[model samples]
Target chain A: MSPLAENSGPDIIAAVIGLGSMGLGMAQSMKRAGLDVVGYDITPAAVDRFVADGGRGAATPAAAAKDADIVVSVVVNGAQTEAVLFGPQGVANAMKPGAVFISSATMDPAVARDLAQRTEALGLHYLDAPISGGAAKAARGELTIMASGSRQAFDTARPGLDAMAAKVYELGDEAGKGAAFKMINQLLAGVHIAAACEAITFAAKQGLDLDKVYEVITASAGNSWMFENRVPHVLAGDYTPLSSIEIFVKDLGIVQDMARSERYPVPLAAAALQMYLAASGAGMGRDDDSSLARLYAKLSGAELPSSTKEPQSL
Target chain B: MSPLAENSGPDIIAAVIGLGSMGLGMAQSMKRAGLDVVGYDITPAAVDRFVADGGRGAATPAAAAKDADIVVSVVVNGAQTEAVLFGPQGVANAMKPGAVFISSATMDPAVARDLAQRTEALGLHYLDAPISGGAAKAARGELTIMASGSRQAFDTARPGLDAMAAKVYELGDEAGKGAAFKMINQLLAGVHIAAACEAITFAAKQGLDLDKVYEVITASAGNSWMFENRVPHVLAGDYTPLSSIEIFVKDLGIVQDMARSERYPVPLAAAALQMYLAASGAGMGRDDDSSLARLYAKLSGAELPSSTKEPQSL
Candidate 1:
């Protein structure tokens, strides 16, 4: 029988590891759905914030995993995910047999399959569930998840998935399918953001108003979700890091690595990755990814719309 | 006094030069709006089609310009626009003085300014009015025009602009601003198409279905206007050139030239231009712009979804 079949009620316990921006929001979403939720983070402040928000906080991943029916790992990348599940003070062996472990990091498909196999060997279900929609959607329980796993794993995680995501695309019955889909999303997202920056800064170079460029492009054939979402930051001259340049540096790097392994040439994504690397190296890695416009302006000596404050350098 | 002010009536004679896809539709739209519309094209068949669609056809550029109050040049680029205006049998000295000349070609801002200055010297008002929304919108009289020029130029062209465009963004009181805005739009459009091709092909490499990638991406942050509009062609394996890859080679070539003049680095647009150039070199230049996906698949040895017919080679 499945763990969900065994529970058969609202008594399922869920633990959320890596309670940072995305994880804390997911923990709150689970708590709102009436699951007994425990949250842990490497940063103690994040755990304390989650506890103050009326969820349980655990000191370690193992403590959080103890007796949990589902453990959702929302870490940064494959390394962090592996550390949380199989590192020293890891939670894999601590989770009850038949429990589902959901991996929500952007990772390589090969790495995802390896981790899934390791989790299954320990009598736990592994669902490859990489997320989209950023932290704002995470807080609203309105994320989009590209997920794949065994039938039993889907059945076991459906309730929590419902609590966390507005749309959960069941891509396949394999462990790495979701990760592959996420890599594709990241590839487009990263490229679009870089393209937006390039176009807007080019507009700046030509003496067109950035605000007007944003207005016209949004209603024209050139528009993208990233363009509409991120151009405002450039127009307002804010680099407050809703998503950072470093994120694309990491995500598009993963895309390039995977493409290399597959012998595929992703020239657009590869080009976009270099822009993010340029921005990150210029000490704006933690700023809003829209800092790409600033980087372009600095390189070309074009004046952008004045910002409220000078951008800080790392 | 402005030509429109002298007339102060509904009577205006408009000629559309270069009756290609966009120009032909725009000519039809002008006729539908009850203007005295005349059209000319280098291709005799295009002129015949315009006449069959209930518009007058002209034998040459001067024939189209004779007695016309507004002349709209919807040619391919700066060269074509200049050819139709100042070449042997050009129309610069043929149109009535104080009549408007609307240049709808995507050209460099400096070239647009030069054209505007030359037209003004010939006692014709020049409006740098480049259009968007493609041929369908042109036919519906629902295009978006990014326009700038002298007040008299705008006044003379207002009636035709109303008949042809749904939104006319008055960008500035100069001749180059409209062209600048159009270049910005082309930069994004070209890059987004290339990005879409890269992402979809990467998905194919990962063994994900292209149709499913299309579905998921259209609903995800990865989506762009080009992705939503062009991926259908890829999915159906139809490359019957709604817009050809060579168009980007020209358009993005303009973008690069403008960027080079400004000493601005447009890495994304540059990268996208390379993809389009590669496609063109591989004999898919006249195919749909989405053939970048096919090129990537060929390069990586990945099979795409079965098409209705085999892709043709040069």
Candidate 2:
């Protein structure tokens, strides 16, 4: 794959249609790269944050995309992405002919393909670009992007893409492949997080020291990226929703749907989804995914470290 | 935890009871450190190999431990450990008074405690020392050992421990605690391996490039130590039992038993265990743990890299 070019940004008008943790950062990154970047979000404060960060604020996606060469959609999932592109006040009709839309939502690949088809039919390019790295990486404009699109789509989104990402995997010349790659990532991430929680809580149940467990497992073959990152929350007895249980609940649910449609039994991903569902159902939908340890503790009467600082109710 | 001292080996007599892959390497390491190391195994060829490696070979645990100050049992599980210590011609009675028994078998903590008590009652010490790092680490004398025992036990076992292990976590001053830590590691390891297999196979089902998935994942948050290490075997269509599927079936089975006894449900481990069992039932038990990917390929009809070179029958 030819590397996408950087900083055509000086002449590009970029629209970022969401300004949550990730989107806000992307907007600032685009602006920093010298793009005339305008941002909009459902949350006014989020858009205002981007504006305060020196981005132009728009009242709607249509207004954001009206004169934009590239529109970046960074909503939560496929439905919101669809709404951003085609719902009332959507950007599709407002986008200039031949302008590109880079969709950074994680969803079923089939959904990604459908959105790309609809977007292309409107004389616009759609780039399926699902991102990795956390919000911190996003804020630093160093996200890892799994992207697939036509050559023209990549060309049009190149400036904004280079501004917001450290690594861009050009996965295919179609929209669905990047989303498929991202789903594989989500399936593993969700399962690993759940496995880490299950393992750590079982350690607690066995009366093994949690801190020592962390030290040992990290150095051992048992370690995972999620375990290393998320176990600190359990060790500190902090269940702040840095990345909430509901995120996996939604992502793994999509994996289940995608696998089901293919008539594939994804036992591990399915099991992980149920645990996330259980965590969410237990009012931890918004808690850190590591809250699975707390759920296991509550269910098994195991003594995890108690925290007076955490909220008692969801 | 006081660091166990190195290579007091010139004067120490160390016996390794079980000359398997791990045991043979450990014995060689002990011999290299100047210990008078004797080794034994049910399989005579293993003992022959150890003997060829400049160590003495014995026909029984008792014979191996007879003049030894430290007896290291590197058998598969608690039952083998128990048999080595108390079966007909076992080491507990054969070992010198005040000698230490280092049990490196992964087992239930309760069994470890029980074995420690029985050995101590016979005027010997038992160190619950479960080892990690694979055969290569063992050969390099750089294994990570999670160990616990009385001060006297640690003192007696120090030379052998230092000779063989790069990092020895002195987790507690009792026999069971080290086993507890080891089981926690196993729980996560088993689950992570199963999840990695599930993920790569699912990616294959999605028709995503397996090599690309590996490239993207190891750099992403979805990565685990297992995924990075084991996926290559899948990519090469090699299922060489580097670490067998049966290993996780056994480890996760142990985890399930441990969790169940505490009435703690480890759904992810349990789910992962089911996948390992499925892989094993499909006659991949003795195949590498990554064979779960092959199992997924079989059940879902996904085309993972295939090998005419791989065995087709159990």
Model 1 C-alpha lDDT per residue in residues A103-175, reported as the tens digit of each score: 9999999999999999999989999999998888999999999999999889889878999999999999989
Tens-digit lDDT track of model 2 for A1-314:
11122223357899999888888888878776677889999999998888786677899889999999999999999999999998999999999999999999999999999999999999999999999887888888899999999999999999999999999999999999999999999999999998888888888887888889999999999999999999888888888778899999899999999989997888888888998898889888888889988888888987888766856443
Instruction: Spell out the clash pairs found in candidate 2.
Output: none
Which residue pairs in candidate 1 have backbone atoms (N, alpha carbon, C) closer than 3 angstroms, thus clashing?
A: none
Q: What is the interface RMSD of each candidate, in Å?
A: 0.7, 0.8
How many clashes does each candidate structure show, in the order listed? 0, 0
lDDT score, residue B160, model 1?
92
Error of 2 at B144 (Å): 0.7
Off by over 4 Å in 2: A1-10, A308-314, B1-10, B308-314
Per prediction, the TM-score for chain B is: 0.94, 0.95
Looking at model 1 chain B, which ten-residue stretch has the lowest summed lDDT?
B1-10
